[model samples]
Target: MIDEQIFLSEQTQDIYPSRYSNSPHMIPRADPVVYGSDFSNAPIHRELIEQYQQQGFLVLDNVFSDDEVLMFQQELNRLSQDDALKQCDEVITEKNSGDVRSVFRIHELSPVFSQLASDFRTMELARFLLGDQVYIHQSRLNYKPGYRGREFYWHSDFETWHVEDGMPRMRALSMSITLTENFYHNGPLMLIPGSHHTFVSCVGETPAEHYRQSLKRQEYGVPDDRSLEQLIDEGGIVSAIGKPGSLIIFDCNVMHGSNGNITPFPRSNVFMVYNAMSNKVAEPFCSQKPRPEYICSRKNIRTL
Candidate 1:
């Protein structure tokens, strides 16, 4: 069966001009997700690169061993339970249940996570895909406690990043390494395959300090049902499910989100955002101020 393409316009902009300040139009993605043409020295094979390019995401199970998963799990427990980190501004609690929802700038918080960020498996793959020396634009630990964790509405990361953080182009990607088994019922991350080809400019005006609420539950910057449906009709949604050591790497503009976990199994993952050093952040396109450093790192670009 052939895959269907919708709204594949001939127009290609130099940059992905996004949905901002009630913008109604959807910009077909012009930027290439995988910039590295020569993968001779890269870890992944040619077929894998094609698969990732065709679909918006790549799922690799057992990317880490049980021992490494255990180490990550222990580190997860420590950081989530740390009195200092729990009280820090970097920590984000669930809106309703008051449970810990996310912890940002975690690579700066713990050496274990920092080490994982620099791990060749994760780092080199990013370098290969981004086609340049990369740095962490952002890193965080996401935990969705069972029964109380809330759903993250469907949206594109680059939409938020570009409008808020001044990310100049769709030249970044996120790699999420699972620290816990992502069961189907545990609110695993979901992506619309092949949906990265378009940029759905959102409808609402971004409020100041939106990150304060967006981390727990994003309200604005979400795609309208019509735009989301159009993309989903062309490329169906798939959950990134796997064992504790699995890795899911996806484009920065891919449409993704997760449901709230009601089952007893809690889901958690370590997320790292890699940006090409040449594509550093600038002034915001829509917002009056850039997001806090923890959410969008403007400095401390590391090569790994």
Candidate 2:
């Protein structure tokens, strides 16, 4: 059941309405970009905070050392070789090649990922930005294998989370750690500088069991060309390219996506989402059955 508080409260109902599934709509963002004000416990400084506020995304290089990257990389290789993981429903494979595309609930799949999720640098930044205790809304390892890798179409994550997972607001953020160097030619993540300020009500109804297909190539909840053009025209596009161990922090509602990685260099990264504890998920606003536990955790919610 949808939380009564979320349905009736002022915070969830009309402030950031989306899906339009019936009729599309667009509105300026209602939520603040920088949710937390106090920086005493913040791992980053004021300039970075302001940058996050103004641009809606920030990239930091050398967040993890080479040794750490190597360890995680090896772990990923191990997970890839484990035939059991390959057959699990949590694993999504590429469209054509059948190579692994993504593995969800990574923290639960391996202790190495568990440690990375709770690492001071990533978690502290999430807490500092959210101004409250936080928890992992979702965790995954995204892979764009060398040639024939697929593209993740442009879309706001909150759009899907709100409609499918029952998240009420945009008090969430994403931490993407680069395990392999993200080169400009190898389908790096791209984002509009200030597009997070716009709420794009995507045109599409939530199909039953959509996550099965959406994880590989998202079709629904995707913004239209007209809407995307307006955003790109205003904020412009920037490719987040960096060496291994780079970290990307972006607003939950930011407009971003990546292209197909046909280059010989494959792109892989660790993705963790942190949501403010105050904004716990309830019943999905779209009325679909809640996504599986691996995708969005509602029961036994734990503060990180």
Candidate 3:
């Protein structure tokens, strides 16, 4: 059940000031938007803010250093091999080969992951997209292994959250930081630009199935073939192919998906979902069982 205190309380606006922007929503995009220790200047931050609002997504290059990426990769690999991780509900594996597909709420379990979630640059950008006091609602590591990675169907994250988790609005966004090269052939994320303007509600006969497992759904709560075809024809899909340390921030309501990885190269990314503290979820509205807090967070503590 959703916490009543969180749902009814008024939101606070105690945001920390940063060199990036005077206001949370005014991030500029510099003439040459390159991410680094000193790339969050006024112009680039403002541009980034505008681009995210207009297009429902923004991709920035070189957000993290190569060494940082290597460190994260090594840690994630260790976690994948850890036998204890198999017992946790947070880990989701491929049905056939048992390869790890995703590990959720990593921040809650690991100190380094928690620090990464609270990273100043990431939190500041998340505040710009969400609000001043944003909460780390969900964090996960997604892995698309070579040759056998699965496909994610076209569905909005907010749709699942709103219906199943009882989130009231679309005041959340996700940051995907690439740990490996997101190549064109390695199941890079595909998005329909400007698709957040419409909410594609879906209904099917099977309600007994779990919602978090998008791949295992017998009947998915996603757009039908005709609707999907029309949406793709009009909006056009974009593949976010980039080197390691690339970052993509996307609106939760955007229609997005990815194909199965057929190439030998593997794709991996760290995904963090930040939610406006004021936009807390209510009681479960559409599902018999609410997913565990590890998958859908109930805490609303401000990250910054």
Candidate numbers sorted by TM-score from highest down:
2, 1, 3
lDDT tens digits by residue: candidate 3, 1-304? 3576654542222121111222212112211111223335432466667677667798899989999899889878988888999788888888889888888888777777888888876887766556447888789988778887777788778767766676666788899999999888888999998677666655442254365456443245566676677668878999999999988989887789988888888898889988878767665455357767887887535544
| lDDT of each candidate versus the true structure | 0.86, 0.87, 0.72
Query: Which residue segments of model 2 deviate by more than 4 Å?
Result: 1-8, 11-14, 21-23
lDDT of 1 at 157: 96
Candidate No. with top lDDT: 2
Tell me the deviation in Å of residue 195 in model 1: 0.8
Between prediction 2 and prediction 3, the one with superior TM-score is 2
| Candidate 2 structure, TM-score to reference | 0.95
Model 3, CA-based lDDT: 0.72
Q: Under the 3 Å rule for N, CA and C atoms, how many clashes does model 1 have?
A: 1
lDDT by residue for model 2 (129-179), tens: 988899999999987788777778999998888888988888899999999
Specify the poorest-scoring 10-residue window by lDDT in model 3.
Answer: 13-22
